[model samples]
Target: MTTALVTGASRGIGRAIAVALSERGDRVAVHYGHDREAAEETRSLLTGDGHLVVGGDLADPAGARAVVDTALEAFGGIDVLVNNAALAPSPATLHKIDETSYEHWDQVWSQMLDLDLRAPANVSFLVARALISAGRPGAIVNVGSRGAFRGEPDFPAYGAAKAGLHAMGQSLAVALAPHGIAVTSVAPGFVGTDRQEQTLAGARGEAIRAQSPFGRVATPEEVAAAVVYLTSPQSQWASGAVLDLNGASHLRT
Candidate 1:
């Protein structure tokens, strides 16, 4: 059975991906940043015994190593690496972006750059490097967002980070092609996850749904299905492509 590591698997899209992979008979390393109980719930939902529950702050280099090491130790080697974990900027526009107390504009940008862009790329690099050393061809799927393309003016930092991530995925696809490794970015539209439900609460979410061409937002499962297919043998030759799973509302004319 193929072994996969899925970060942020405690809930939402990550949880769905973990369950889907497990159902297909692949062992999964479910990585969660916080909320151990939620992570365990994900593990419990798995049909088989190949799922491992790993939790830690991936922003730290050591923590990142632990996430990958534990999975490798348990599953022997990783066949798939899903960089599904991310953090959005707190509710504030560029005028009020003060989450980081850096003295200069460049410094703050660097901090945001590290968290949103560098972390996933670093983690993917670690996993892909290991796979190369072990003589195994693997797949790396990054859960990006349509924001990477849309460039929300209110959330410039996030959009920039995601855009960088998409570009990095393309570069890795070419760099790892000779090794038979595939790197793909799965960009989802406004997904109706728990966070979305709470944030959009009541009439606002309803109104937004009505505006969509499909009259509803994409679900976590829909995005998970895309990730699974990209990792499957049918898409082995597909890499560096950004698969937009939006509901057609965000399409460019």
Candidate 2:
């Protein structure tokens, strides 16, 4: 069976992705930034044995390497690496130019880029290198965002970082192909996760749903399903692609 490492698997899309991988009989290493209890919940929700719970602050370079090393040790080898951890745009992180202070803007931008873009790049590098050394064919799927193209007025740094992530995935895809390692990314639109429930129940809910023709936001499972497919052996030829899971909300030319 394939071994998969899913970062930020404590909740939201990461949790759903871990569940999907486990359901398909893959051994999963659920990595959480914090919240050991939540990570344990994710492990318990899995269907089979061999699932592991790893925790670390991915924003730190050493922590990111330690996370990969822990998973590699537990699973022996990781066939799939899903870079799903990110500092999402919450009220606390939102830095609108007009309303936010310069210091706040700089801080938020740095934090978001560090966790969202650099962390994933570092994890991907570690995983790719391991696969290369082992001469194993593997896949790396990055969890990007539609905000990269659609724009995030209130959270510009988020959009910029995601854009960089997508670009980095493409670069790695090309670099890793000769080693039989596929790399790709998914640009998902707004997803209906538990963390977003409050916003969905609020006054702006309808407006957010109306962004897509289906009049609803994407679900975590939907994104997870796509990730499952992208990381499968059959999808090796689909590497270097940034598949859009935005439900036609925003189409790129």
Candidate 3:
């Protein structure tokens, strides 16, 4: 069976990815940042004998090692790695951003850099290296955001970080190609996760929907299906690409 390691598997799109992989008979390592209860719920929903949960704060460099090591020990090896965990919506303007305090511009930007850009790149490299050392081929799917291409005026730092992630994915794909590893980025528009639903209940949500061609947002399952496809052997020839799962919502200029 194929072994897939999925980060941020506690909820939202991450949980859906884990379930889809498991349903397809792939062994899954559900990685969680904090929510153990939610992680356990995801693990319980998964089928098959080798499905397991591994939790750690991936924002820390060492935590990244712990996550990979545990999965390796349990699954024997990994064939796919999904970098999906992320923090969101810092809610600040460019000029208003202060570069001083812990929650200010610099710190917030650093946190976003660490989690969104650095963590994914680090994980991809380590996993790719492991597979290369063993003379095996693998897949790396980095969860990206439409904000990386479209400007998020309210969340500039996050947009910047995701933009960096998009660039990183492309570079890694080329760098790891000779090593027999495939790397790609999946950029999605607004999804109907719990947090996203709550935000939609707030002001400006209706207005945003009205602008989209679909007149609605995407569901977690829809995005999860894309992940499963890209990570599967069926998509082996499709790498170093940015697959837009955004339903043409960002097409309107």
What overall lDDT goes with each candidate model? 0.84, 0.96, 0.85
Error of 1 at 6 (Å): 0.3
Off by over 4 Å in 3: 90-103
**What's the number of clashes in each of the models?**
0, 0, 0
- C-alpha lDDT (0 to 100) for residue 127 of candidate 3: 87
lDDT, candidate 1, at 228: 91
The sequence of per-residue lDDT tens digits that candidate 1 reaches over residues 130-233 is 99999998999988888888875656667888888889999999999899899999888888888777756776787778747889898899998999999997
Ranking by TM-score: 2, 3, 1
Query: Which regions of candidate 1 are displaced past 4 Å?
Result: 89-112
- Model 3 Cα lDDT, one tens digit per residue, 88-207: 764443323433354566666777788888888777777888898888888999999998888866667789888888898889888888977888889998888876876788896887
Pairs that clash in candidate 3 = none
Across 50-85, the per-residue lDDT of candidate 2 in tens digits comes to 899999999999999999999999989999999999
Q: Which of 1 and 2 is the better model by lDDT?
A: 2
- Model 2: clashing residue pairs? none
* Clashing residue pairs for model 1: none
